[model samples]
Every structure is written in structure tokens, then in C-alpha cells.
Target: MPVVRLCEDMKEHPKTSKHKCPVQIISLDDQGGLALANEALSQCLEQGDVGDAPVCLISIIGEQRRGKSFLMTCLLRQLQNQEDKDASWMGSDDEPLEGFEWRSGPETVTKGVWMWGEPLWVQVPQGKVAVFLVDTEGSMDLQRQLETSIKLSVFSILLSSYQIFNILSEFKLVDQDYLEMFITVAEEVGKNFNLYPVQHLDLLIRDWQHTSTYGVEGGQEHLKRVIKDLESLPGNDLVLKVLKAAETQCYLMPHPGTRFTRSNRLGDFEKDFQDCLKDYVTTLVALPAKHVRKDSNGHALTGKQLAMKIRDFFQFLEENHYDFSSPVKMAETLANMREQVNRKIVDIIKGEYSEFVLHQDRDTQTETHCLNISPTEMQKKLEEKCQELLERCRRELLGDEQQKEAMVQDVGQELRQMLEGFMSTYNWRFKEMENAANRTIKDKFKQQYKGYITDQGRENKARLQCCRVQPRKMRQCLEKKGQELLQQCEEELRGAGDRKQAVLRDLEQELTEQMDDFLSNLE
Candidate 1:
């Protein structure tokens, strides 16, 4: 059975589990007059001045059995162990998946405020993450709680393996059946989610999310979309020239001849991402009724079509939190709504890129000149091969590296060890997270307030707003890179990581020796 015990520190090294912070949640009912109650609630939340706590409120909305309860519970688990960076997975054979992987563990956090019918609040890692999961009454029936839902900084629409997009497109399942529910949800998200557009854009470029991104987010067309769409957004136009001139050149990795090379690159997806973002930004900034409606339903797209596709993308962003930020205080998160929009564009590109890699085969047959020569000729080929032949071999090395690169193999092993070490420390943090101020919370609120008030007109990239990072992805990336270099590192680290990286030299000798042995066996 899965371990349901909650611990603050998830990545503990066969060590003590007495550290992690706790998660507190109180559940409330889902039945009530949402319009009236939500209005009063928003006024209270907006004005409460909860001194020590954060003001950001989250509203969880979903159809019945759409894993709403499951997602909420999982989210709470993350919150409970906010300090546990070690909340990682052990090998999947016998041990259970913990934290993100394992839903049921003994680890728990200091519980927070919760309500049943009203709103259940759970903490988030950074900012003031309190999820006000509003449980609906009837299954698959959306309770029109626009006032409360829109007030949230982020909104999520949960789906299970069975659930899909277009709630109204498939069946008319609300009051008056005039898409009143759909329109309300869409407009609220678009408006509040798009607050202070110009200011948010500046923050995005200079503050929360890192500007050094090598993805589509790091390019000229991307910046243009932010400027053009944000400028045209229904609201404000914060930065003009800065947005106009913000340009980027996408590189798969650092320049060629670098120590590390990108395994696979996606150029087309980068362009598509830019195009979609440009179009989306333009639509929102203009806030024009240019969206064509296929049916009488007020949704911009036809029965689950393009015009209304923004809402679906918006929902995805809120759900998975497709935002970016440089923890080093680099980019502005809320300088404009384009930050969120940019993330959507990023997600679309990343998804396509991942597919590009996954769908392609790791193995392929290539035609080669297999000279029908006696053993004598085969020896002559390697012995006589000089500069030109070696260069050709250098080019082939990349393909071999892609297929069977020991550097990647060695790096992968080391990455696992490094990740393990990091996780061990991470789990330790979870145990005593209460001592440290919620860095996540502080960073988030700081960015939000900054994005709200920063000089959007400033063209400098330094004064922008930012996203709140918890070092999760960084650690993961480090681990991945390490894994790729594990084997190479074993030999390199043999001398205590001091020796020059002779990876290509060593691997080539080893391969040549192995091939020579194989060929000689014919004797």
C-alpha cells in the first residue's frame, strides 16, 4: 500500500524525518449563493490586510469526479512539505513515489485554513499560495462563482484521464443554457488574469522570469509579440520601445565548440510558438470582437474552437503553472499579461519539442560504403585513414554520440548521484521550513507588487517583475546533465575532477580497440 503519512522532508537520506514543515487545510461545503457570498468574501480578502499572511487567493473549479479532490489533495501534499526539496522518487521497483510522485506518504505539513461548502484553502510553495478549492454541489455541474474564481491570482480547471476540453460544446449543462456560465468564466479569467498589462510586461522582461531563456521566450519575434499584443491588449501599453526592440537569437545550446551540445533542437516549434503568441497577444490587447463564432454560443471559438481556445490555454497555464522566472531576480513576472501568455507560448513549444524527440527513433539505418575487401583491405582502411578521413569521422562522432555516447552515459550516472545528494539536503529543509520565512511566498508577492508598481516605461531589463522559483527544475536539470556525463566523469573524477576532460580522446581509443578486436576475430 502507498504510504499516506506526511513528512516535511521528503528526500531524507536514510536519515531522520523530524524536519519538514506541515500542511494545514480545513474543508467547507460547496453549496451556497456564490454571487453574494463571493462578493462579500472578495471584499474581505482584498481589504483584510492579513498582516503576516499573503493576500493571493486561489480558486479551484472543475467538473464532478474530474480529479478535483485528487488534485487538491496532491497540491496540499506539496504545500505541506514546501521546505522538502528532497521530495523525490526512489527507484520505482519496491519503494513508493513520494511528494510529486508519491501521493500517499507519512510526511505532512502544518495544516492551513480550510472550508467545506465555502472555500478550502491550502498553501503553495511560494508567494501566498492558498488554494480556495470551491467544491461544487452536483457532479459535472459548474457552480457559477465568478466573483470568487476571478479574484484568484491563478485559476485551474482539473481533468482526469476521462475528462476533456469543451464543457459546453459537448452538452448544454447550465442555467438558461445560453453559455452564461462559459462567458462568465472566460471573461473573468481574461480580465483579472490580464490586469495592468503594460506594467506586467516590463516586469516580465526585467524581473521574475529569467530573460536568458534560450527558448522561444528568448527571441526577437517573442519580444515583438509581447509588445504588439500587449500594446493592443484591451488594457494598457506599458513599455513601447523596449518591447519593440527586445530581440533574441535562439541557440540550441551555448555556441558550437562548447563542452555541451544540445541533443535535439526544434526550430519550427520555436517559430510557431512565436506566431501563436503574437496572435494571442494582439487579440487580448485589442480586446476586439474579431473572434468569429461558429454557433450562437457566445464563446469566441466554434464548438470548442480557436477563438475560445485561449480559455483552454489559460486554464492549462493556471492548472500546471506554466510560468517562468529566474530565482536570481532577473525577469518581471507581472509587468504585463503577456508573461502568462508568453508561458503559454513556451508550453506549446515545449510540448511540440518533447514530441519531436519522443516520436523520432533513436535508431536508424544509414547506407555506407561496405567495401568487399579481404581482411588486408579492412586493416588498410583504419591504418591509411589520415586527416580527411579523421574529419569525416569527427562528423560521424556526433551521430555515434547521439546513438551511444559514453559522455552522456557517464554524465547521466553522476547526475543521479548529484540529484540524490541535493535531494537529501532538500528533504532536510522540509523538516524545519517554518523557521525560514516562506521564500516562495515572499518572492511571489514581491514580484506581484513590483509588477503592479514598477516603472513599465523603463526599458531596462533589470527592473522587471519575476516569478517565484523553488529550485525544483534547476536541481532536476543539473541531475539530468550529470547523468549524461556520468561515465566520462568517473574517469575524470578518478583524479578528483582536476584532470582535463579527455572524454573524446578516451572514448575514441576504447571504440577503436573494441572494433579492432572484433575484426581480428575473423582470423
Candidate 2:
């Protein structure tokens, strides 16, 4: 639950005494794996002197081939495009531009370059980091990857469904290997912190780009696909910005435990919250109404007979003849009275309920006010609420599991079928159609014309040559037959020109009439 937010130098985070960087050696297993990893990590951490370099590492953890590389590319390019807006280093005419670093090969350093510089780190204004973006192998083994993943200081889990159904996710979601591993890691994480809806890559930018989707087989197309994914996501301004930023950062590490996240809707620690709500509703219906007026002799009676009788409340009294003046006597009697009648509206009871209700949302405002309560009282009341919430959360989780189990299988099956159909249709044919239809007539014409047309065409050559030879005079040469060869050549050349012009005239006239007829038809 304790997340370490690393700035450029891990300033706010206390440096791990064993190492300069704020690295925690986590050991979720007893196999001495943590110790071994930590030793390696300690060395890695020592070598990593963040310096004043604005760099932070965010690791994407997920099942194999689940769009991790694509997601990373999308983030990187999205950032580059965004950076272009500032009119800075991007697209400068004078300088050779610096393009972002990205590659998809498995052994490629850090699983596709996740930000080569500090552009993304600037988002955390209060913090500074030179991001060393990484995508690890073996997300198939979720537990170990996650334990390793958390070391990145930030991570994200991606799941896709109409509603995130785990079983539906079981097959259609991520690979079985990854799902098992990540879910276990997520559950274990749940034990520590209330997870919020994770920030996943959503890209649909491909829609607007005029480019071919072709690339090396199985190479990254993350930037191209995720842009369109924004449609299904919740439209929260901050969250959307957060996600968009996540894309460029070469990672999305949106934590689930934070407020305003899906975790709020989880209702996990939801104690019988509605009970308290109902009580408040009832109180609003009633008010600070005086109901009981008991005398010093403890022979108290309310005017409303509908309420429980005071004689029944007296049954709580252990000794009938006890000292009335003792504070302890009054306390016992009151306690007994409350337990016995169970219907009396006590002032103390109302006060306790109000306090509990006001602090239900234990956040900034509520927490500040809670300090007013004595530690003991707060603990007792909160414990009661906490227990109720946990119980409710458990019930909800079970109900969700049952409901999900029954329906998710059907949905997952449907989804798998739909995905197959989608792949068949869209991935191949749809893309083919898109590729086919994508060309504009003008574009096709230009492409077709590019090399076909000549600047110094035959007509120009003929025009230049025709200038010195007078057409009428050249025809006259046929009559001079002095050189029989020249005479025949001149005759044929002159006749050919005249015949060609005549034919072209006919074509022009025919074309004009056809165009006129077409216009008339339109009218």
C-alpha cells in the first residue's frame, strides 16, 4: 500500500540506507528469492545515480503479447506529437530533428524505448525524473513479475471487457499464465491497499492518420490502435489527461488506491453504509425532539406511549437499591436501560451515530475533524465500522464472483467468438477494404500521371520542328518531284499531320457533345 513516488533524485523518499536510491527489497516468497534479487537490486540501485537528471522509471506489467509494446510506442509517439505543439525542437527547419527512440524486438533494451528523455517526467512538476522506461519479460508468471514490477515504483494492470469481469478476462482478457499471476499479485496488493481502476493504454489516433498500417509481422502497432480505444473509457477530464499523459510517458502508472478512481465504487470496505444512511434519513424526518423526561427517582416516562416503557428499561439495573448519586450508578443504569428497552432514543446514542456518519468518507476533510475525537472512542467506533465494511466487502466480492462466474463464461465465450469474427472481418478484410477505399480519385490520378506525362512532349517537339517547314509549302514540295524520295516523304508527313488534326477535332467535338448531354441529363 505504501507507494514510493520517486522524483529526479528520490528527494522526498528517504534513501534506502543500504542503497542511495529509494529501493525496497520486497520478499513475498520464502525462497530467499527476495534476498537474492535485493542483492542484484542493491547493485543496480547503487549504479543508478539519478543525479539532477529528470528521470523516473515506470514499468508496464502484463501477460505476454497483450499490446505492451504497442502501448509503449503509443505513449512515446503521443508525447512526441504533443511536444511538436510547443514549436520547439520538433520540425525545426535548421536542425536535423530528433525523433523518439522505439523498437519492438524482445531483447531490445527495456521493451521498446519508453521515453528517451525528460519530456514525460515534466508532468510531475513537484518532482523530477529522467525516465528509464521498461517493459519486462515473463509477465506470464504474474507473481514474480509483479514483485519485480513494484520495484519500478509504479505499475499498471490492463484488463478489457464490457465491464471488467475476471473470468471473461480469464480467456479473452489476458493469457491464462498472466491472468493467474497478475490476479494473485493484485489480490495480494489488495491486502495492502484499496486498488483503484488502473490506467490502461487507449489509442485511436490511427483514425486520422493517412498512412499504411503495414509493418514487420508482429511488430508494434500500439500507437495506431490505442487512439481509437478512448471511446469506451470514462470521460473524466483529469483521468483523461492522466491517461493521455500516461501514453507519452511510455507508461501508465495510475494507482487504484487513490481517490476518484474506480476503487471508490468498489464498495469493498462498504460496511452497512446504507444502514447509517437510513438512520440519517430517519433523523432528518425526525429532529432533536425531546422524548424522555425521567425524574431523579428513575421513574421516568415519555409522553408517547408508543415508545418502550421505562419499567422495562429498569430491568437492566443489577441492584434495585443501588446508590443513585454515583456516576458509575447512572452509567450502569443508562447502559442497562439502553440494552433492555432497545427502543429508547437516547441523546448519547444519537451523538455517537452522528459522529460515525460524518466521518464515513475518511479523506482530507473528515480526517482533519476526526482528530477531535479521543483515540479510544475513535478506535472503537472505527473498528466497528471497519469490521462491518470488511464484512460487506467480502459479501460483495462473493456476490460478484458468483454473478461473474455464471455470466462471464458465456460472455467470454461470446467474446472469443466475436474476437475471431472481428479478426477475420476487420483485421484482414476490413483493413483490405480500408486500404482499397482509402485512395482518393485525385490521388490515384496523380500517382498514375507522375511518370507517364512528359514535360517536353511529342507535341512540343512536333511544334518546334513544324515551325521551319511551312505546311502549305511542304505540301507544294510533292509537286516538285525533283528528288522523288524527298517528295514522297514530304507528301506523307504533310498528309499525316492534316489527318491527325482532323481526327482530333472530331474527338473534341464528340467529347463536348457527350458532356453537354450528361449535363442535360442531370438537369
Top lDDT prediction, candidate number: 2
Clashes of each: 96, 21
Off by over 4 Å in 2: 1-59, 62-74, 77-81, 86-108, 111-134, 141-177, 197-523
Residue-level lDDT of model 2, residues 1-523, one tens digit each, is 2122112333322343443222322222332121112232222222344332322233444444333443344333334343443323123223321222223233323321122222232333343333333344333434444334332221222111000111111122243233333433333222222222222222212111223321111113433233335435554333234335432212111112222122222232122322222232232112111111222122222222101121122223223422222223433433443233322322233344445544442421332343334334444555565345333333222112443244334433443443344334323433333223322322333332222222213333467553544434433432232234223333332123664355334433443443344334323
Error of 2 at 68 (Å): 4.4
Per-residue accuracy of model 1 over 1-523 as CA lDDT, tens digit each = 2111122332321111232221122111333111112222222222232222322222233333322333333343433443444322112223322321112223222111211212123233433322222222232243434322222212221100011111211122241122233223333333323211111111111111233343334534344544465566453322343234222121111121111122111122233333332332222222112211212122222112221333433343344422222211111222234334444443443344334323321211111122122224333332333223333322222212232244334333443443344334433443234112223333333343234222322322343345322234433433343344434334332111322234333433443443334324312
Best by TM-score: 2
Measured on C-alpha atoms, candidate 2 has an lDDT of 0.30
